[model samples]
Target: KLDMRRTLSEAINIQVPYNFERVMYLLSGGQNQTEAMLKMEQTQVITLSKDLHAKLQDWVSTYRVEDSEMLGTVQNLWGCHKYLSDPHTAVGVNAAQKFLHGTQRPCGAVICLATAHACKFEDAIRKALGSKFWDGTVLNDPKLMPPTAGSLQKLPEISRGTFREGEDWTQRLREVIEGRYPEATLVTPHLGTLWFSNQAMAMLLGITTAVCFAAILSKFARRSKR
Candidate 1:
């Protein structure tokens, strides 16, 4: 449950109320994310933190979410409705409502996609509500169990093969370079932060890979002469 994010909470929340009669045993840690992923489900995760927010760009279509506006919307909703909306959902709904108001569009109803459980971002919610969140209906609700503390203590286990920030990404390249051109040097470029420009680095990596192969062939020729 400790590793649980808001998106997963949204899915489970829907599953529970939609089928409350049956016992929905929620799996956590590696069991659900790792094991379930092994089944070949076409899962796509969109995280704004990574600047891979291109996923939501398609969802919003025309609307662009800015820094102050998005958080401002989230906080506004929290203080007003006592509803806790995660950053993703907050940006989305806030954009939609603003657009509709600006256009003066008259419609029967406009549906905004709220993707996460509020309990998942309890701290963020508290901040949004100005640390006066205990008065809110969401975290104070008696019917629901806390997301992190359900019937059991949360596990600190991160999924295997998960990408850690500072790991040696060039380890495999280093191995090849060491075996072939022991004299040659390679520099690992520090990608400052995750953004679309990372794609340009990807193309650069492809070119470096070709250089690696050339070095490997050079080593092979020298060995054959001996």
Candidate 2:
């Protein structure tokens, strides 16, 4: 993978295409290694070199490469499809556009794997598209998340522990290879699309309990009145 860690600020996200172990895990029958080699042989892999990644970063915008690329992608996608894409999806958009342009033939329609809800990166969305759309209308405002919730800086405590920060270079790199900290064990070998950790379950339980308690209180109040 491209080591743009030095070039891009730590805050800026660099979403790469794929990691090898994950690919191997998928190709290797997901559990048994019987079909691994065959599956890998059949699979077509695309790699973006460090140089190419840097070039793409620069090409996306002349100034503030990291920030501009993702921001530009979010704006461009929103303009085209009336949908907001996360940084990861924006990376895919950049790659697809770059790939299609390189092709000589007429590219009919390219597929962009839009991952994650755009509201998750509300701050990024706001920075890219502004407080409102071009028409001065808000996108999913008031009742739901606005273009920016302004909470991007404050990452969830559970999510924050996933990185091995302040560790040695080798250990830090190992953390990436392992791809999970104590908090985010869901990103492990489990192939399921949906993953909810204990913390998530606890939060859900708390919310449910609060609602049930409120309902009980309301019923008791009604009974007293009757």
Top-scoring candidate (TM-score): 2
Worst 10 residues of 2 by lDDT: 185-194
Clash pairs, candidate 2, are none
Question: What TM-score against the true fold does each predicted structure earn?
Answer: 0.35, 0.38
Candidate 2 deviant stretches above 4 angstroms: 1-19, 24-66, 103-110, 132-226
TM-score of 2: 0.38
Residues 1-226 of candidate 1 have per-residue lDDT tens digits of 1232233122332311422111111212112222222232333321222222343343324455664566678877766886667766887787687768776442335678878666565555555555555345554564423655433224332222222347665763444334532222223233222221233345556788899999799667755654
lDDT of 2 at 31: 40
User: Over 4 Å off in model 1, which ranges?
Assistant: 1-60, 103-109, 132-140, 143-226
Report the C-alpha displacement of residue 126, candidate 2, in angstroms: 2.0
